[model samples]
Target: MYHTWMRFFTPGPAHHRLGLVCLGVGLQHGTLPTVGPRTLDHHVAVVVSTGRGWFRTPDGRRTAVTAPALLWLTPGVPHHYGPDPDTGWDEAFVDFTGPTADTYTELGYIEPHRPVVALSDAGAARATVGRIVRAARRGNPLLEVETSAAVHELLVTLRRARADTAPDGEQVLQALARDACKPLTVADHATRHGMTPAELRTAVRRGAGCSPKDYLLGIRLGHAKELLAATELPVAAVARRVGYDDPAYFSRLFTRRVGMAPVRFREQQAHTVPGGWSDQVPDPDDPPIIGRTPTG
Candidate 1:
């Protein structure tokens, strides 16, 4: 028998507001029943372990995800999923909370909730599934760190998968990330890409799901996170590094979308590292913003 497990959170104080949960799901050589399109008030995720399946989302989007692939479902959007008929499917899923939950949604990292994805080249998926399953088996503080590390790896995998699909998108994203610490405009980007401003805007939205300007801004914010977490730099320097000339404006934007100011988020992360902080960190980079918004 397949059992569904879930966890919910009741927000009270800032420190007590986050929630996390995971489930191991399976369906024998039979069709998995269709369920209502459910929306998460927080972040959610699904990883297929075996078999093949198709899922129809609330918006009528049909996704064909096979074993070893991942289905990232962010909060506030209607979602529905089930097994594909040619073969049955088994899956593992996890949901958690943090300041970046909304930011993930804004980037479309969790939208269209049920896209069938190829799980090829995802080193983190295997390790994460193992960690989550082990945690369910062991249930200890060690599990918490393992799960958190796995989640971070999964997020990075999703970002990479988005870029690997479109080299142009990847290039554009890198450019945006690298330039995030400076002032830029679509026209400037278009000129660099050898495209007209209008053409660039259309291309960006079509491929990345957001206008170039918004995507660039996201990159800047992502960089701001790096400076806050990995360095001792003040928010002002971080803002400038990510292309925001005005620190106050950057802080406001970060707080509004990311749910916390840069300083607060940094503090929160400082105390939450899975292990001791490492000096060897990536060069404060921003990932390409794919799925920046809903397609329909």
Candidate 2:
């Protein structure tokens, strides 16, 4: 409902020395609209506060740049974005660039691959942007420094919001459990899920109360026990089926971990009371979904 702005700031020498400055900012209501696709020399982030719109790249990729989130327009990236004429989005944006900005990108605070981060705490994000607008509009004496601080806060808000909306550490742990049969190292599994080895280790410990390696080992050992009890497969075949390449190596490791050799465990299980052994076996990673009801 307020007027949109596209005014440039007359930055001071100190702002230039700090290597960080807010070039421009605005609230894009119906008063201002994006005409077409074009690239720019600086970075801009636009938060869609209401309504709906679409963002497109030169590579023919398009995103539904909807409300409660923001989209990035990186420097020199051929991009186009606009609101629906009938349901134009209300947006607030800040155009920024400098060494500090580059440093944030280097530190993974600003990831182009994850251009649109959900404002899970929408009020906080709005409040941060409001500070930037206030600083700019008032032409405060320390406008650049104050606005820069607000921008940093905005970046942190983006990160916290995304984290708030992301799946829990336990979800990642359970996902890895589901694929326990895969011959993947803890580091490999962690990388696939966009986490470092250290991060994965900590997450596994926190979520599953064990190390990543140990969690997978528990799953593998559980499956091994099931196979040994229910099937007639040889030790070597069972080892290979459960992702162990070397039968002797598997036997040694299994013996060390399970407190008995694979063959001996099978023999001991065979004497167990009928029908009890099957129930004692834990289910596989992917269970049958034939009888499950779909949830919302």
Candidate 3:
């Protein structure tokens, strides 16, 4: 036997005011919804909390949607997925749509084509979905605003989960942590790790969903930010601390990636936020941009 409940949000003009709209939220046990090959007009994420299932796409691809995994049905993308009849499954899911969806896709927060992803932090994923479910159930006046924030958190959680599970996930991350203050090329990075540049490229891309160059730039810029905010270091000194020897080139790169010159960033932060550091600190052991958004 199985039990289920779902809350479908009315897509009124009120919902569209937020960046993301929660179209529907659901929880089920011992059963899963039927998803035959078809396209949808909005994005839906069917996440399994327990048990297991399979997902099929339009081009005849199949994926095992195991426990703590997600089957993303993106808008206009043909897909199908459901639980195993014998074992069944426990699952929670949310359907959402907004401009942020496309932004997430572009940022690799959501893989529109890749349907199934095994989450590294199952507990966290489940917790986030639970929050979404609770918010939906509340049906408060701030429904759209609160649900949209929850959806953002869910997307970030999903991104971290997938990246943390990728092959060679920690190698490049560790290198960046240790060497963000040193000058190194992608080839040098690969060679030090006993991998070809191509292999390193793929692994880093799989783990972080960015090219090696972009990843390293993110690392350097993140480090540069801390120095700009906390230290009285000169612009050239700040650049050098983050591995750049040429201050002019470093300033240009920083301006491009961070949307402000190093000196300007420092002045702004110092003027406004007292000590000027954000409360959410980036974890030294985690990937770049963990706690901060890249302006670029």
Candidate 4:
């Protein structure tokens, strides 16, 4: 959601040789209204705080930005983007331009071709946007110098995101497929193209060093382990949570993958507690029924 009011500069008496303009725009939780496309001579950067959306340039390249992506727009580039209908978007944006405006361009930093750059540190990017917006609104004497400095940091972050994409590409895909479902099979993945299951298995192994089934199993077991470590549920409950209904089968698979049975793993961890352990207390914080006492 873009802010409803757009600030503009006055032409006459307001005109000055050294002008520093800053505006802060924020949208709450609602669908973005239709906006007419336009171009500007100022630098524009949008930091999406929540939800998902697509940034489409006039040339038809569309980049998707969700919770982790920052959008960069340069002067004189025609652009249009808004929130997805299902989930409304939240974003902070700032546009500033002056004599030192070429600093961003000189670095070849603005890549509107890749309109949305996913932020490695989303929190840091959000904080930076807040600072940029405040600096612009301050109308300080050194606005150009301060704003340019902030822009420099933003450019470096953008470059780092570009470099990080390649290494994480396959991992991201595997994670996506695994999350799509526990029953996600190699045949289903292979059908992503016209390829067969063997081809998909070969490709996944070549790129990820593991078969598709093994990769999916790793995801499932990783999820099961987290449940075991974080919750007090029984082995059956943990197995069900990770998509297995039969505790025995889940235990067999877990032992095969983890080199230990689930109960053994839990017992090993319990023995590591300081004063020994007891399951007599239904809740860890409450007092035990009879002979049980708190662990040291």
Worst 10-residue lDDT window, candidate 2:
274-283
Between 1 and 2, whose lDDT is larger? 2
For every candidate structure, what is the RMSD over all alpha carbons to the true structure, in angstroms?
11.0, 15.5, 6.4, 15.7
Better of 1 and 4 by lDDT: 1
| Tens digits of lDDT, candidate 3, 153-227 | 988887777634644567667775677577888888888889898998877777777788888888889878878
TM-score result, candidate 4: 0.44
- Whole-model lDDT, model 1: 0.63
Superposed model 3: Cα runs more than 4 Å off: 11-18, 61-64, 163-167, 271-296
Ranking by TM-score: 3, 2, 1, 4
User: Tens digits of per-residue lDDT for model 4 on 1-296?
Assistant: 34443333232223223443342333244577634377776667676768898878788777676866677777778888878888867666666555444544443455545667776656665566555556555346655555556655655555555434455446545554556334445676667656788876665654444667776777778767766765667999888877787899999999998999998877665333443334343665664557766453
Clashing residue pairs, backbone N/CA/C < 3 A, model 3? none
Error of 4 at 225 (Å): 54
Listed in order, each prediction's TM-score against the native is 0.53, 0.55, 0.82, 0.44
Candidate 3, residue 35: CA error in Å? 2.9
Question: What lDDT is reached at residue 208 by model 2?
Answer: 51
Candidate 1: where are CA atoms >4 Å away? 1-43, 59-63, 66-68, 72-80, 97-99, 113-123, 137-139, 175-185, 198-296
For model 1, residues 1-296, the per-residue Cα lDDT tens digits are 34444332232343333332232322123455655578766566666667777667666878776666776665566767777655656665666667655555555555543355665544565555555555554336454545555666666566555423567766766776666556777788788888898988766765576888887877777767766886777888888887778889988999998998888899886543454344444333543346664222
Question: Which residue pairs collide, candidate 2?
Answer: none
- The most accurate candidate by lDDT is 3
Off by over 4 Å in 4: 1-29, 99-103, 136-145, 161-296
